[model samples]
Target: MIEIKNLKKVYNDVTVVDIPHLTIAKGESVGLVGNNGAGKTTLFRMILDLIRPESGEIRSNGEVVAGHENWKTYTASYLDEGFLIDYLTPEEYLYFVGGLHQQNRAQVDETLAALGDFFNGEILNRGKYIRDLSKGNQCKVGVASCLLQNPQLLMLDEPFANIDPSTQFRLKNMLKDANKSKGITTIVSSHDLNHITDVCDRILLMEKGVIIKDIATNSSTLSELEDYFGVGQTLGSVPVAGIDEEENH
Candidate 1:
């Protein structure tokens, strides 16, 4: 379980994020949604200890995340392209990440094999440095490296921002498989509302560093979410909007 209490971050007199309390259980997939500057990235960074929270505490499995060695073993996060080492090739990067988790090269290869065509075969054998790869290819390598260890807690920020449609589909299926098979607790942030609606068990909407709504997908539809986002209006019992019209057709 992940528990956050009174979490806060301030930057240059601006309160970026302030969450009184938040908890995520094991085997749950959560979607963090918001427009730009909503502090979603900030919150993810704090949880991963990449940034220091001004005040508050975050605990994963009863241990404080900031100083806990277990967090390194249990958590795997991909927040930005900078997380990858520019000097390492994709295979070397994957091996390094696995080594940090005490996994062997054979295990790394086996894991990579399971990802199928998502890596385009070149990722494992490409001799060039990560810095030479394209942005989308870099993201693919980063995500592949993160999942190589099968971490219990997975966090990704804007994971689909630059990938192609086919790779995006592959990633969605891969995440679903990981969650179901290993009971991984996953948190994802995306600008694509359809992606969030399709993959997230629950969705949390943030605005200007604050969480405005938390809705469960099991009890809600995309239309309800559109209304909540103020992208459309509710006409009587139905949502009246361009999206609803598109859906009907």
Candidate 2:
């Protein structure tokens, strides 16, 4: 569903993303795990065409993504609150997004209703603009908007960061269902190793702007990642947080 070739992005002569090649198949759930400055978000932004790569190219389906509009129709993403319209209420923002896909108000409401568990009653009818909500609540709104689009390819960056445990569980289930049942291809970048391993079928470990490992998830995948990050023995049962957040890319 997506492909990258010799992709590279740099700032101030420092290389941030240097992917030689990568492909994500349709209906596959792939996790991108990397420490800060590993270029996960930079890779995502290139895929979304939010920023042009200094070199190389990204393609969705068969078309190059750099100068294309077709991919947007089947793709949905949320990297941070910057993706949201801070002045708009949650309902208004969702409804506006639904309308872009030709869905009516009732359709948007139905989808929101189905997401009640994910929202945990913290979103919807809150009567406040998106900016007023807590970061966790804002994340819920962002993710809900993505689901509303019913995208074929979904990409989220650090989605597990601000949310609580219950919401995290709900999100895992939601992503799993979207991939297994709905056949939506997913690419998620996260620091929480346990959740990423649970939700993704494949894992890609990145370091210093390059993909260092691509492993299919199995019973021992989490431990393998822990070992690489040098925390397997010391952090038993605790989530392997990827090295500190990457400086804004």
Which is the leading candidate under lDDT? 2
Deviation (Å) of 193 in candidate 1: 0.9
Task: Tell how far residue 20 is off in model 1, in angstroms.
Answer: 0.7
Estimate the TM-score of every prediction. 0.89, 0.92
Global lDDT of model 1? 0.81
Error of 1 at 176 (Å): 0.7
Candidate 1 is scored at a TM of 0.89
Q: List the residue pairs that clash in candidate 2.
A: none
Each prediction's Cα lDDT score?
0.81, 0.88
Segments in model 2 whose C-alpha atoms lie over 4 Å from true places: 231-249
Check candidate 1 and list the clashing pairs.
none
Over all chains combined, what TM-score does candidate 2 have? Answer: 0.92
**Model 1, poorest ten-residue lDDT window?**
235-244
Give one digit per residue, the lDDT tens place, for model 2 in 161-192.
99999999999999999999999999999999
Residue-wise lDDT of candidate 1 within 1-249, one digit each (tens)? 888887899999999998776778888888998888999999999998889999999999999989778787878888888999989888888889989878999998898898768986657676789999888889998899889867898998999999889988988888887788879999999988888778887777778887656667654556676675666343123322211133223
